[model samples]
Target: MQTVNPQTILKEKFGYDNFRAGQLDVINKVLAHKHALAIMPTGGGKSITYQLPAMMFDGITLVISPLISLMKDQVDGLNTTGIPATFLNSTVDGQEQAQRMSDLRHGVYKMLYVAPERLEVPSFFSFVQSLNIELIAVDEAHVLSQWGHDFRPSYLNILPLLEQIPGHHALLGLTATATERVRENLQQLLQVTDENTVLTGFARDNLALKIIHNQDKRKYVVEYLRKNSDQTGIIYAATRKQVDELTTYLNKIGIKAARYHAGLSEKERQSQQEDFLYDESPVIVATNAFGMGINKPNVRYVIHYSVPGNIEAYYQEIGRAGRDGLPAEAILLYAPQDMHLQEFFVQKSEGSEEHKQNEYDKIREMNAFANTQTCLVRYLLQYFGETVTKDCGHCSNCLDTREWVNVTVDAQKVLANVIRMNQRFGKTMVAKVLKGSNDASIRKYEFLRELPTFGLMKERTLKELTRFIDYLTAEGYLQFEGAEFPVLKVTSSGAEVLKGQKTIQKRLEKIRIVSQSMNSDDLKLSDNDNRLFAKLKEKRLALAREAGLPPFLIFSDKTLLAMAKLKPQTDVAFLSIPGVGEKKFEIYHQDFAKVINEFIVI
Candidate 1:
């Protein structure tokens, strides 16, 4: 196998100076006809693995995608790069489909994107036979595994088609999220040996991860959008109704936002997505369905309005930002009720009891992530089978400046109460007993009168007690017994804590920070500095107006804030802020710096 120069290809064809990390290596292996599985982060250039190889190979590359919009987006993006690409899916009429097949047979397209369902059709199979196939690329390949975080039944049928292809063709699987189980499934489905497998590490250094505690998520979301008005970002909700409600709320607050979800008509979804892609809308409030195939680089943040099912889903959603190798943010808002919602989902799923139990266990593991005091990035990476020594200073936990108190004694007492109550009850009953809540249920059960540990921790609210129990379960001090209406079972750790043989420490809960007054200190600028910053912003707006771009395209608020602080004397120093790239620096740096210099002297 010859080594293809990815840099040369990047410059000549894609107009990029270099390949992102793991791109060149993955592409090289694929070009050599080796079956490969790439575990790249969401914005980590996974597409180029097979895309660049497709350009170098002799035949058309067939890429199987799960979403129809994603296929169209990829096809359009390929065409923009002057690559002849087309897609076959239900979106195209019968006549157009026939013509596309004819085009494929006549060697007109170098890359072809198709949905998995379409791949099962006889006509598509015949077309594949007629074309010289270089490789088969499966995007979101983790969907093929039933054990994966997100499973699609349509993807399960793609394995047999690999054997049906006529010529020598390599297989490439790409996804932002895949655990060890999902990786094994990909190998088995693609028939790739262990030696042929390539697992890229899942550490995304450019993104800062955060989990914010907020019971009133809607208020927090609204305030966040209002404060960060001129940024390109995505807000993910768990349901379509949420997407709609949040979109409407943003509009009510004077933010140009749109909603995307599966419930929307195909045309509506397409239009909304295009508007967002074209910068007609700077923000998109959406469900998980919105971001699979859409590639809009330079997204500065991805905010989760609700907790995701697992770390895998979380990583994939957050991967949408910072694709252009720039800094980005991923924030998650969580509450205890969210765990109950996930538990409900687990109970409602149609599967074997054991399978359901496995899913429930995974959900607990995921919920523990919200309560952890360790490095958020390291925790996420560890879930995906990577090891990191130190905490990432960019995450919320690292930036937090709060004092912690030991809760081991309280935890021991709580466990003792649960044990005294026979371990047959749920978390609610145990919490009520601990908080001295003599509710009807507690009174009927006579738990309030138990002298062993009744009202010992009355200072802690019901919410606090419940959180401690959740932490206890998360840290293995308590376990859930598998039965209808699951019971909380004290573990060995619980026993030790009860006997004073071990100690369990927990951070004292911090008060949730409302987004209303965040950065208020900075919001108060000196009158002179405010006037100067306003002038610089006016100059920026004028340049943006002249150039027909958004104000953010000229400079972000962070950049303006930096200008106020640094009061740069030269263009070089002025361009050093958050979003002032070379292109913008060339356009507005000197003018802004001159304004600052003149104001400072005055």
Candidate 2:
């Protein structure tokens, strides 16, 4: 028996010319039976590190993933590529689980992906003790660290099992988003050495980031989708109702869309996810729950309909787009009120006071990402403790050439009104008084009408004044008291403005699709090749429908574009396309080549 070269496995099985920057290094360390901590960016070939080794290893490689969707996607793709892989997750039934366990015992598998929660099962833990497990790869490995964004207690159970399994076993911890604190924690927990740690700096050249503040979110979404009508995107709302509303409105306007949230049944969520993945629904409006482990590679954009909980979650969510190494966009529709809801969650969440404070600090950082004048990418990278040299020159802030106007008068107006109200009213009432709207709440407080600050800025609309107040709150000019029903209070910063000691330069410009040029689907498709790309996509959809596999599993749009451009007729020519391998060429080469030939004739 001869040992297979990783490069040969790379080109033959996985369909790539070479290992991505940090991939081979991590693979080599793992193959040497050394634990590795790989901090590659999302879509940076982290999977290949463990996957190629799994094929060459003598025993099964156990992959612990947090989400069932990720498990299913990878398993499906690996199995399609002729690498034997399966997942044991909540989605599997008792009979199937039993059968899979039997197969594992018989050494019929090379790699197995399981949710972290499964390690806690006594039967599952005991059954695992008997198997020859060569490697343990923890995907989204930051979950093992409490300091990380998405922490899971179940991840703690992974390392102890590795100790019990007596053998030369290697552990691999994988994550794209890890702060310095989180990275150290993962290294300590996984017992990974510094030499084996591969830190690929976090930067998505294909992804353009945009942060849109103080805009009409619903209106912006509708218009933005209409502009990018042909593209597929994920719209993440902060709540279930928002998801439903956006989905309904998008569909009502003749745009195909689906909604997903915790409110939906398991079967319903699965159907919605499939609809999006299959391209039946080109857009999905979902809460944070929809995208963690999703393996959809061709998502054109990701729009956060509201501010996410933290930069960690936001950065990870945006990493979902442009995964095929194609240009994609990430738009964050943020407003000041969005922060209040997240702050409320942090305050009410189950944690120690220290934990709550840490969460609060994260919220402030997320707010800074929205409010910062620096590069959006720089802010995010800096937050994750990476040094950035310059601006991305493509984010909303960089593209925005709008002049900042002095809003000192407006700030003073808002502050005086808050002070006049004895700092007792929330943003809404304060705005209503500023706009001179004698609503029922105002009538209830009859003394408010005669107040010196009341109706001082009647020139502004209720909405405009409300937004300005929000900006003030976000900028720390005003503070909110209480959690659920917060009231506005003037911060010392606001007092300074009122006293003419400081000035505020506010850029409340309504953010449209500012990155239209940057976000353009400017793929390198020639006019003649564009026709073939469409035809190839049609063939892909047809084959995917027949085989019951995601279209990307057969071939990514990136590969399809290559097939169209090169118009490969021979097996050699076809396999030369990136993402094409011997196994893939054997399965799909002829069918795609036939399509290309037919298109050429037409």
Please report the candidate that would top lDDT against the real structure.
Answer: 2
Question: Which predicted model would earn the best TM-score?
Answer: 1
The reply for model 2, stretches above 4 Å from the true place, is: 404-602
Model 2: per-residue Cα lDDT over 347-427, one tens digit each: 778866666666776776677568766578887788788888898999877887878889898788889989999988887
Candidate 1 lDDT over 500-567, as tens digits, reads: 88876656567665443225475467877788888888888988889899988778876787678667
TM-score for each model: 0.81, 0.71
- Location of the lowest summed lDDT over 10 successive residues in candidate 1: 514-523
For residue 152, give model 1's deviation from the true position in Å.
1.8
Candidate 1 lDDT score at position 97: 86
Candidate 1 yields a Cα-based lDDT of 0.80
Off by over 4 Å in 1: 1-4, 349-355, 443-451, 481-485, 491-502, 511-602
